[model samples]
Target: MMDLMEESRPDTPLALRGGTRSGDHEKITVNLGFVDLGHVDLLVSEGVYANRSDFIRTAIRNQIERHADITRQSVARNPIEVGLRRYGRAELESARAAGTRLDIRVLGLAVIADDVPADLASAAIASIEVLGSLQASPAVKRVLADRLL
Candidate 1:
């Protein structure tokens, strides 16, 4: 049961602002198609993102920044967070070495491949900033909860 007042707050576990955190403020409204949104929504379903808005906001930002020659602002954007399942240990370690850990929060329930077990996910949890992955499966959730919730 979603509260009408929480229209802006989707029932997903994760949510992120469009740009880097700077205590900024801006607002705009535009309609996007369902097909495009479905693709983004898949990421949300896969436990890789928090909600529809997070995926759409990131997608729109990427599409806009793709025309970087004119905007000249792409250089400041954070690296993308897609393709999360394929990430290797070395890559995670490299990012962990950086002063600030990245956010890999997922929302709702999620299913990880059987081949990949909770132990591995447990290790990965240490390398992130916020680990709000409600989507993690029972076993994976148990492994990661110590670091996240």
Candidate 2:
């Protein structure tokens, strides 16, 4: 994980602690109407965008920009890790050894490695608050379901 517990200190802005290029991007599926898809294709064909992905990225960026203030406020209010965060068995084991419990709050992707056992995850993680997405084995997901926000 990105260790937001330190970054979310009283004076720090959670959003400012992490870089934009955290190299953790989530793949999402969007259901668009046929007309919208056609319009996106048209934009790509007309050289407005390199491809559909480019067009959608631009559109999402614009929307995020429009609501930048609200996003910043929300990030400030919550202890959020703004980018991708992954936790593996080794990390959880270390946390367990150190008697540290994790209260994971992420705005982007949060992944618990497939190799991590459900019991270990339950012991190591205190809670999960993910705004975007979480990827984990079904067993771990079930164990943490009540703790997920």
Best by TM-score: 2
User: Which whole-number lDDT from 0 to 100 does residue 47 have in model 2?
Assistant: 100
* Per-residue lDDT over 1-149 for candidate 1, one digit per residue giving the tens place of the 0 to 100 score: 11111125344323343222222222233343456556666887998878765665566679967886644443235332322334344554555456434345332122344444565666545633222123334786576665653
lDDT score for candidate 1 against the true structure:
0.46
**What ranges in model 2 sit over 4 Å off?**
1-25, 98-100
* Candidate 2 local lDDT, 12-69, one digit each (tens): 3222233322345444445555566678779889999987667767888999999999
Best of the candidates, lDDT: 2
Single out the weakest 10-residue window by summed lDDT for candidate 2.
Answer: 1-10
Please provide TM-scores, in order, for all candidate models, with all chains considered together.
Answer: 0.29, 0.71
Question: Global lDDT for candidate 2?
Answer: 0.78
